[model samples]
Target: MAGTTEPYDVITMGRTGVDIYPLQTGVSLADVETFGKFLGGSATNVAVAAARLGRRTAVISRTGRDPFGDYVHKALREFGVDDRWVTPVERYPTPVTFCEIFPPDDFPLYFYRRPKAPDLVIQPEELDLDAIRAARVFWITGTGLCEEPSRSATLAALEARAKSGTTVFDLDWRPLFWGGEGGASGAGGATGATAMATARPYYEAALAHTTVAVGNLDEAEVATGLRDPHACARALLDMGVELAVIKQGPRGVLAVHRDGRTAEVPPTPVEVVNGLGAGDAFGGALCHGLLAGRPLEDVMRHANAAGALVAGRLACSSAMPTADELEKFLASR
Candidate 1:
């Protein structure tokens, strides 16, 4: 708690799970015989990425009080994130995700988080308002809004920022855990109409408090049901979002400000290896830009380049680049 200073760069709260990725690409999840494991979950991924970039970061969530919980704790420490707010709960097992990642194509995730994952136990009453109020940036995800107590807690985390004027960003996540009975599948795939309807209200509420919203093209359709990037951006602003980012693979990203300013970041060239954690990288780099007080154009470029670097690597947390590494990668362009 001693390190809870004014604007400690970044603070985040949401899902914390283990990711099991197939070691070999271009094969089915069932066909793959070997898998690689790493710390997973959108909010935690963003926290790790920001910390790797030398941002002072803190996390708020719960992990199962078990060995898996220990792994999550160790991972956070390894990344230099302040885990003081990360709680461990009893009885439930930690959630885990399985993905099939083929280069230049698809990454399908199957999540095992049901019955009472520890992250869902996070309650608004347990939140430390001071940390949320004083942070320079707060990152949230749609995954937290998919359920009950966590939903309330997610909204509460934004309340202090709402008053403090902290820059709050929304990361869109369409996990299999949502849209009951295998309804929502794939990122931005129209596979979950029922799930989309179920999630809209919560996402709209989330956007109401967000200063910026970031996600891929499909992620935008999944969150807002608007396919056109510009329309999606406009819809987000209408919901009170100050900035909206609609990511276009290969073509780059288009950012729209509520003030009518628009900028497009050119894509960073890279050999596609795995596209699993690129969005998390973008979220972290965007935090870096905002915390450093860079121009909007520069922010998108930093984020775009960060994402490209991650796409060329494997795993999630390990793929997050350090500041020097990212600068080096950018310098090459």
Candidate 2:
């Protein structure tokens, strides 16, 4: 479904759903702990953040004709994201993610995603290709590429956008969403090693279309099998991406461009209330900076500040800072 009008400044294509009951500190599946629901999913979070920053943003994805879907729509609207391109399928229920936030320990946090959720059933026909082609930048996430008609649809959209001169941005590599396969969630029965194998092809497909690539330190290690941050960033750049940003969390961010320039941006120190959506905030701000023609160094700095701000907050979308707030933070630094 191609849109009839010309492209926007930025349009995001990927999954959309709800995150039900994210556990608070010390919460686990065994004992009762406080939980809070937030509009989750990587692509949606970035879209909301970009829109709130006053960008003309649109989202292309599928959701179920259920309460969760309605909530997703309402949240996007409230954040000023254009939802005209979002499709609602009545056959399936919307997807939900349940995660357990453990007490502060040396171990990493754990997450559990539901299988074969509605957001995973997106087909090529469900997308509004015209709108995708009309955008100056098309942003996507690795989680959405972990499944079927949606996977093919995502590739198609990227190809179309590329031909139209739209910059294609990819947040590479999420192993959990890939299921057991090496591709998107691996074959349904996949588990352990088998699932990881199933998700590989989809990852390759995504990498082929990526113009700007972003990932955290662990993801960079997984994606390129390289421990050195600079080498990992260079590997992505060699894969034909114009820019590569490796988010090092508390350590900050490192960016490399095809023009042989590199920038290291330090993270802003803040007490982290919740670490969710920080990557999405960084992605959105990075896109905004690039689209506005800011220098790569400044873009990395802005993105670093945005990510730090989001990480210090408890809510996902609500944690995103306003333009004025972002400016204030920048000035104070």
lDDT for each of the candidates?
0.81, 0.72
Model 2 C-alpha lDDT versus the unseen true structure: 0.72
lDDT of 2 by residue, 1-333 (tens): 645575677788776778765445545645646667788777888888887788888787777888888998898888888887677877766777665544222223333334355656667766777677767788877667777777788788777667354365555555556653223343443332444455556655666777787888666655565768899898877777888889886678899988988899888877666667778888789878988899889999988888878877767777788888888988988
Give stretches of model 1 more than 4 Å off: 1-6, 180-190
The whole-model C-alpha lDDT of candidate 1 against the native structure comes to: 0.81
For candidate 1, what is the TM-score? 0.92
lDDT of 2 at 88: 81
Best by TM-score: 1
